[model samples]
Target: MSVILHLFIAILSLIVLLLFDYVRKIQFYKHAAKIPGPKALPIVGNALRFIGKDSSAAHDILLDIAERYASPCRLWLGNKLFVGIYEPEQLKTLLTSPKSMEKASLCSLLRPWLGNSLLIAPVPIWRAHRKLIQPAFNPQTLRTFVHIFDKHSKSLVQKMEEELEGGEFQVGSYMISYSLNVALESTMGISETSDSKMYTRYTECVNRTMELIMVRGLRLWLHPDIIFNLTKMSKEFYKCITWMHTTAHSAYDTVAVSLQYIMLMLASYPDVQEKLYQELKHIYGKVIPENLSVATEDLKKMKYTERVIQESMRLFPTVPFLTRKVVQDLEIGGYTLPQGSTAFISVIKVHRDEKYWPDPLKFDPDRFLPEEVAKRNPNCYMPFSIGPRNCIGSTYAMMEMKTVVAKILLKYVLKKEKIQPILTIKQRVEIVAHPVEPITIEIVKRLPNTFNT
Candidate 1:
């Protein structure tokens, strides 16, 4: 009697487990039924095909689909469904409906690296931080940072002067060093000499964390362990995570320094270098502080300088893509996206989209002139994004960029050297975009009266 009873119980257990598995599969298939996608394998689904790439294959695949479908389209990976919406109108719909279209869980991957910082915050925290940090970047406050911006920019020119003293020019490395030094000063409010060891570690942590985010995001398509074990990511991944936390903690103590460093690198352009100096002289006269920050009111007055800075941001946005998920069955551009679908609004593609910008490849700052800007679609150009969730640092970043540019232009003659076949700038994907190749240029000191704005 005991043996018979045990056999019955075992059969019942197997039946229960199989039923549960079947139920889960049905639920997933039901949810994903309407979405269209490439064929997925039984267990791995489309995970394997998506994981093999050097760059952002997921985004690239979506782009290809959008082109092929000619409107909003759907794709699937295993039981997961995705809706690819290309038009800005559709993007607006997704962003405005935050409760229904929440951020993807993939963003959770960034949390381990960037913390709950404004760059990746969601909903309430994102909104609150945006408000708190917005005032800090206001036009008035930006004026105070000009002096520091100019100083570091000039220092960058000095470094270039040393590098190209008698040889052919390369602006890539100089731009990188300048960018690093400027970020250090502006973000931390420290002098360039504050701490080299800390800065090196900070740079390393940032680079590694960015690489990890990109790699991990790609790995999501695969069954987690197969890739994790194959790559031996267990130990080193934890170390990178710990290092990221350390950097974020230290960042608080160094905000002003980093801001200054970033400003200096931005202002090193040849086209408007001299004019920037005159503006600096006009504002601060001969007397200037070692470290400076401006009030909100003064930043508004520098319109021309602001325009130039705005142009630079358009060319190089910090964040390349904006991702969101749908919570309900919805129709976008004639296609229906059921609840729990992932979406990405490609900011980079939009910025470079041919239909919107005339000669999008050219570098023309005047494209942002007041009259010209009036003709533009507000949604078409969002270097810092738009709506309630727009970048909080928009004003602050512009001010810093302008101030540094103006200051350096005033002191040096930045010359883009003869066209060389090898000169190039590659974008490094991270929480923010970084220049993979250094920018090199020649810097000759300008006389006091050489150029005037």
Candidate 2:
């Protein structure tokens, strides 16, 4: 009788707590009625429907709702309501607001891995880090690193040519390797190490860490601490974190890491790669002394390579979505959003929105053709995001991407490898999107003498 009574009391307490939570949510929704959204459940809200869907599908559903309501809309995940702010004007307001309205806890989860890196520090820390690191990516500074980037690109090309006797290879995987290499070398001033144990660990860690963050993002309502203690999932996450931190520290010392994806693409894409190689050969052919100081004039000439990198970013943006929270009762698109609401800016949708880009699905590099881009609105093409909190590493990321791509393309021919169907990468929201699988590609080489001879 005593045991049964205690059980009843515990159950009653849970019921009361759930009821109180429900009433609070109901009150919020009543006030938020002006904000359009699908009906909510008793306690979980739309989280039940959203929990299983990937980011792309969720955005698709949100788009449908936005279309149905004929304006920006709202979604409730548990008690937290997120309003979808789709209009360019509304986005401008949210992004430009002086207050920090865009704080998403998902970013908070990344602190364990990224540390105080510019990726997710508080605005002040973010500002300081951005300032300190800004010089590393200056056009002149980046140009100096061109030789360093080129050296690795050449080595990778040689490795590929030796491995594959010139055949069709999955070019996309190589792009992954190249991108990884660029990130390491450019960001930390490192070189590439062949398929070594440490290199393998770092690559694995990057992916695993990303996967853990995605899981945590999905289960934000259920505190990750509790989940971490109870499952093998947590073990894998911590292991990855350990490997990543150690490898990063090692790279800082050894000055060698892997640049996987970007170099891979350079190797596979013949036309772009050839053009970059010719430019490099022309610039370096006369035996200019290797100087760490690169001039602005050198970068100005690589216009087409810049266009290719920009186009690649457009097609495969690092972050597919951006989110923010409403701290107070706010109005957007004629809807009254309640305090403590969340808002997601669908980047993929915005980029591909037919109204903004004609033939949005097609990969036409010239769409960014100087004259054409001038005609378009800035909000339509924000892969690095925009406004005060925009990616501080924007200039650096672009320069690094262009430089690395330029270096590799200048030397090797990248062939398209047989890629399996693309799986949507579910990783931590960080500097860029990371795939779930290690992108595999066979690298082929074009002998340097052929072009000069």
Give lDDT for model 1.
Answer: 0.57
Can you tell me which runs of candidate 1 are displaced by over 4 Å?
1-49, 56-71, 75-78, 128-161, 164-194, 221-231, 247-304, 418-426, 451-453
Worst 10 residues of 2 by lDDT: 250-259
lDDT of the structure predicted as candidate 2: 0.59
Model 1 lDDT per residue over 1-453, tens place: 699999999988977875786586564456455555555565446567666664444545645566565435555554455666556776666666654335766677766556677756777787777778777676566666666656666665455456434543544344445455655566666576535566566566656766766777766542364555466554566586787555434322122322222332333443444444555556655443323334334456666566556555565556666667666666666556665667756676666666776876544567787888888776778777766666666555565555545445545555554432211334555555555544445555656644632
User: What clash count goes with each model?
Assistant: 51, 28
Best by lDDT: 2
Task: Name the 10 consecutive residues with the lowest summed lDDT in model 1.
Answer: 252-261
Error of 1 at 314 (Å): 2.6
Return model 1's CA RMSD, one decimal: 6.8
